[model samples]
Target: MSTQINTIPASEAVRSAEERIASYDWQEFATELSGYGCAVLPKILTPEECKEIAALYPHEEHFRSHIHMARHGFGKGEYRYFKYPLPDLIGGLRTALYPHLADVANEWNARMGIDQRYPAEHKDFLKQCHDAGQTRPTPLLLQYVPGDFNCLHQDLYGDLAFPLQIAFLLSEPGEDFTGGEFVLTEQRPRMQSRAEVVPLRQGDAVAFAVHNRPVQGTKGNYRVNLRHGVSRVRSGQRHTVGIIFHDAK
Candidate 1:
């Protein structure tokens, strides 16, 4: 009698991830982003994977620097920027998500009267950032305890901003945290700032404007300034992984 083994090929795993990203209704996502300046994506990571990524937080070697938000007036929580040679899952996600986001970035840039256009691949964009003296990686993992929060701010690293960024909730909303809602504020010209509360779940991700986006106006297209933050966490702890395409200065 012969024994049998069952296993998935590495190529199959990559193909599945690629297909999952490609199969998303990006048209709908684009519309949502164009209308609201942010879009929430379906579950891209499994619950187990979310837990696994969150577990990496305690390991200091993986991170180059750990930031205390309160010390920097950023908020009450803390976050760590990953060092070079990111984890395989993170690097893969960064690469796989870039092309689709680059399309949207280019469209927004054109509409906003900006001349900069992103490259088709993430590595090419990183190279451009490096050539401009931005060598630090910007991808980070953020942790928040009860009463911890983040300030409404932009993730502008240098002159070559990608204009788009994504954050994934690694913990369950109500179970892991209560009042830590994702908040975004838009400053339209000649008007009061408007706040938007985005709802998310574990393994869910949101793509949002890093600084600003273009909105159609009577004359043509106008730029609206935007910022994002986390509301105070009422109870429990929260963890999120931020995927930023640009390198930092």
Candidate 2:
């Protein structure tokens, strides 16, 4: 069902966010996660910006139209993840949606631990990733986990990829729900299953490369990737935004 979208003055949110992000130095994060890969950008979006995004949910709903494969690992009735696209508004979309994410991506790129894997791999093309046959060039997806969850697996979308991903937690998380801990894989090769569970609060975000770390080859040394999944929210609903960037792909 289509719902109404209420657009607020989110440009101000972006502007304020830009200032904070500029003054904020992630040098510690850079030092700590050199090889591991992690950065926590707090309050990137004001409460208002987040609320506005949530408001556009049903109005911008696309998954309702198509069922992309999700991890219903528990069973049939069990929904693992509800991933959908986000709309791009001008004063709304560009300033409101992209800046903070772009900031994270750029910051992570400079770090040694979290390699800007894709761009390094695709130097042959004019851009980091090539958009060959795909219809929509840069696709953004949001996951609605109203008890749904994502089982651990590397997001391998052919070669058109974003090396790392960031989650924009739009809800109160635990307060709004429970059991949605995001587990991350620490070691690889010998043992591919050990993962550390990290619980993120509302407005908080987590970032990491698809594979665990940077590979030496132009292709992939594959960081074993995180074998992640949600613990199961027995109570409330969960809404998360995941934005992936590929060179034009």
Candidate 3:
């Protein structure tokens, strides 16, 4: 007797991710990021895909490190950072999304008068981070329950940082969870901090600045500091996957 095994090809997964990413209006996304410091890509992943990724959260072999947010003053939930060999879907999305974001990152640096620029390809950029002693992967899965929340923070892991990062909501809003809104805050120079509550449904992704972004002023472009977090969950469970391009030290 012969046994049958069902598995999807890695290349096929990557190609699918690339095709989905290519379907979005990236120019509009870039414009939105330039203006609001964040943009949403609706239904970037299918509901089934989101569930599959979220289900990986409980498997220890898929992660390198597990973090209890409260223990580290991060928040009330927990998360795990994926190891070197990220899951195919996560890896594929990371690779496919970087080039488009790289263009925007370069433009933001130029506007902010920063000398740093990212490479056109994700692998080349990862090499830069690895050479700088940031060899650990930063992609992670986060889980939250009722009364749990994430503190406002930047995902900077080293001196080499990607300006933008993306997070995908894996669970439905009204069905699987409630009151866990994605939030971003911007600190403008000598002025008040502005808060934005970004609404997201299952399979939706939001890309935003990791630390600083250029905001146009009367004279020239000025820099505004940005941080992101999740608001308190009121009921049920919430799962999310974050794609941070830069590795950690």
Give the best candidate by lDDT.
Answer: 3
lDDT of 3 by residue, 1-249 (tens): 111111467787789889999999989999999899999999998988887888888788888999999999998999999997788788889999999999999999999999999999999999999999999999999999999999999998999999999999999999999999999999999999999999999999999999999988899999999999999999999999999999999
Sliding window of 10 residues with minimal summed lDDT for model 1: 1-10
- Clash number for candidate 1: 0
Clashes of each: 0, 4, 0
- Which regions of candidate 3 fall more than 4 Å away from where they truly are? 1-6
- Give per-residue CA lDDT, model 2, range 1-249, as digits (tens): 223323344555445545655664555644444445555666555565556555554542433332333433431113122222234321233233344344444454454355443322212322434445322333333444445566566665555555555666667765777766666665565655565666677777666556545324445444444444455556676656654444332
- Overall lDDT per candidate, in order of appearance: 0.89, 0.48, 0.93
Name the TM-score of candidate 3.
Answer: 0.97
Task: Give candidate 2's total backbone clashes.
Answer: 4
What is the alpha-carbon lDDT for the whole of candidate 2? 0.48
Give the local distance difference test score of model 1.
0.89
Highest TM-score: give the candidate number: 3
lDDT (C-alpha) at residue 207 in model 2: 62
TM-score of 2: 0.64
lDDT of 1 by residue, 52-108 (tens): 888888888889999999998999999999998776677778888999999999999
Ranking by TM-score: 3, 1, 2
